[model samples]
Target: MIEAAFRVLKVLEESDTPISGEEISKQLDISRSAVWKHVQELRSYGYEIASSRAEGYDLIASPDRLLPYEIEKHLKTWHIGRYFDYHDSVPSTIGVAKELCRNKNPSELHGMVVIAEEQSGGVGRLGRAWYSPRGGIWTTIILRPAIPVDHVFMVTMAASIAVARTIRKFCGAGALIKWPNDIYIGNEKIAGVLQEISAEAETVNYCLLSIGIDANISEEQLPSGVKTPITTLFRACGAPVDRARFLAQLLREFETRYREIESGEYHTIAREWKSLSLTLDKRVKITTPRKSFEGEAIDIDEYGALIVRKDNGKVERVFSGDCTPA
Candidate 1:
């Protein structure tokens, strides 16, 4: 039924004038009543359809939701986001991606992106609550990568670079990467990347990269009492951004960087990440499951670990942790 609706929408989109239900029925080989039903379905998904006795139906507008159909319109990636799933609301895209991995072959599910308009139970590093409201891009990409287990952090690095590039090129925002995996504009965070990996011995079985971006959210939409300052593209740019276009560009950038790592171009990833670094040469606080310390964030090693010089004149390499500016 949704497929028929998509076909109906296609016909309507291609036509300059209104298309009659009878013409649509004949083109799609469905009944006129079915055409009307499909048109209603499109309307429910935030499409504005105008119906007239003499003029038939006309498409007036489309909503800002990250519907799969909408994303596919602007998508140009070869693999990443090629297979897309969208939800109006979910507990988390991560959970959905995990479920899909269990049910389907990991190879077949590679580069599949599961997106949600909102998340009720979204989480970030260290099991912190991620404020996933509407007007944000909350998604998880399932990957069956061919890279070694120790280099999995490159996935997060590639993602952060993709996000920063997309925001800069598409939205005209000055975005930069914070150490580990966060995108920042000025002192506030605008996006974050979290990775969950499955591996055995030295081979990575699969990886789930969950990315959340505050695209079109407003100040009122932001929750109170958050430890770090969080800003949205809308607030930053003084207007709302096109979420579909931004996401499409981001996926393309990510696929490009992911391909680099697959070909053993770790230095390319490291170079790009360093050029866009906001954490380097800054005082920072690194918190792990066991300990927390303040130091000067020096550089990122080849494996994506952060190298920091502690106040006591000792250098520490952090593999996975929460990094914030001190």
Candidate 2:
């Protein structure tokens, strides 16, 4: 197992000197040959292990890959991210998560996560395309909650809060949530959330709560023709924030807020979301298929609709639109 091999690596790292295969086998309750095999496995994963009959095995270094063992090691949650699937590149993690849940029962995908190092055709709300290059967090969480379809948008809200909180603590960015589902730092967009639902009227089956963040990707790696200015945690912090650690923290925060939603704490979550919102009280333009209007973002209702006070003194509830700050 990768986790066992990672444990062997941990032992080698903590040991001041090289530890013999016999000692490792005794510690792990396995044969010396098994320990050697584990060492070989670690080596295959870009770990430089120095082996010698006289000294034993020493960990020289580890590659900066997003291994499951690394992410699971720091993950502390009841359900979220308990089962993770990682990929170097994919068309979309959301697509993969939807397919994964399509074959399983509700209880089977309570908190399954599908993560990708890069997404070629990542999706966003309103049939928009998301720009997801490498060195970013592009993952989708599969949730089969018992909530009604009207309240399902809260999943995206919960994920937004989770990402904002994680960036605040981990990357120390004063991250703010744009109305509906986007994260911004100052005036630049840093992350976005897209929730794809499979529902019929008031009933719901599953939801793919997908989030994409520019965690470590440089500005150069971002799509050239991006509409809005973008920045990353690496640019903000002057160093690369550990993606595995941030993912673990985000999952933990998300689980906490997700339980609140399940317990009917919508107002509580909305209050927190408002506190970190960049859209509230700001002049904004909402574009729908029929028409577009300018308004002041008043508040978010219980059903996650944006209540806007228009310039014509008419208040409008925007369920879905391309919200742009004016």
Candidate 3:
């Protein structure tokens, strides 16, 4: 019922003039009295609706909260954010997404986005602690793709591409994709992607693609002794870009790339990913559990694995590891 009320409010918001209750009732197929009841309900949700004799109703202001109405207002993708679960504060968006996948129907919940304004216990890649301050964009996207388990890593590549493209589009064209899911602006890290999946023997059930972008977070908010190098959109661009707009564009781009992957168009994204890659043709050091090698990143394979040609005339394809350019 609250969602229905919000839908009505959104219609009123798009209109240049006021909307009458009768018109709303006719459009929604609800009675005038029901529309009045929904209006009252909307008011309780912190929506200021102007009710007068001349104009039936008008939306004055919506609460500055991360509600589905606000998120959907800026969202542009068809499936990426069709369902949203927003929280003022949560332990972790990825945690919530994982729990949702277990309890709910995964097939019915495609593109469900979990967003938190503040995360109390955010987790990063490889069990690292992620500092999710209030101003940053901390969110996770739930996806159910029918792809082979081996190709699941492509989702992380898609996310990295999305974040890098978003930063470049908003800030400038200098943004680049660091190896293994990090976005870099010059030398400082601006964002990162962490892809978690639930799978069976040889098939993936669902994937929780979490992305953390330092939009307006300050340096003081970061923890001590953990600084590799970090930069925010505010610091890079001299001003804070609109988070909603950036998220919208990011989701749209991600959806496009994700669909391409589903359609076996990995070569297309691979081409773009290579062009935008910061690791390609650069001397780098890759560290894995078994061994570490210093080499030059030559290309990324169709499976999104990094291919590095070492100094010893040996070529290696890395599936997952930490990469640092030498």
**How many collisions per candidate?**
0, 0, 0
TM-score of each candidate structure, all chains considered together: 0.97, 0.93, 0.84
Clashing pairs in 2: none
Can you write out model 1's per-residue Cα lDDT over 1-326, one digit (the tens) per residue?
Answer: 77779999999999899989999999989999999999999999999999998999999998998988888899988899879888999999999999998998889999999999999999998788999999999999999999988898999999999999988886677899998889999889999999999889998878999999998998899999988899998987778888988898899999999999999999999999999999999999999889999999999987999999999999999998888878
**Model 2 Cα shift for residue 243 (angstroms):** 1.2
Top candidate by lDDT: 1
Instruction: Write the residue-wise lDDT of candidate 2 on 98-143 in tens digits.
Output: 7787788856887888888898998887778888887889999888
lDDT of 3 by residue, 135-182 (tens): 889999999998788888888888888888888888884888987888
Rank the candidate models, highest lDDT first. Answer: 1, 2, 3
Residue 145 in model 3: lDDT: 90
Q: Can you list the residue pairs that collide in candidate 3?
A: none
The Cα error of candidate 3 at residue 233, in Å, is 1.5
Q: Where does candidate 3 stray beyond 4 Å?
A: 1-65
Assess each prediction's global lDDT (C-alpha) against the native: 0.92, 0.87, 0.86
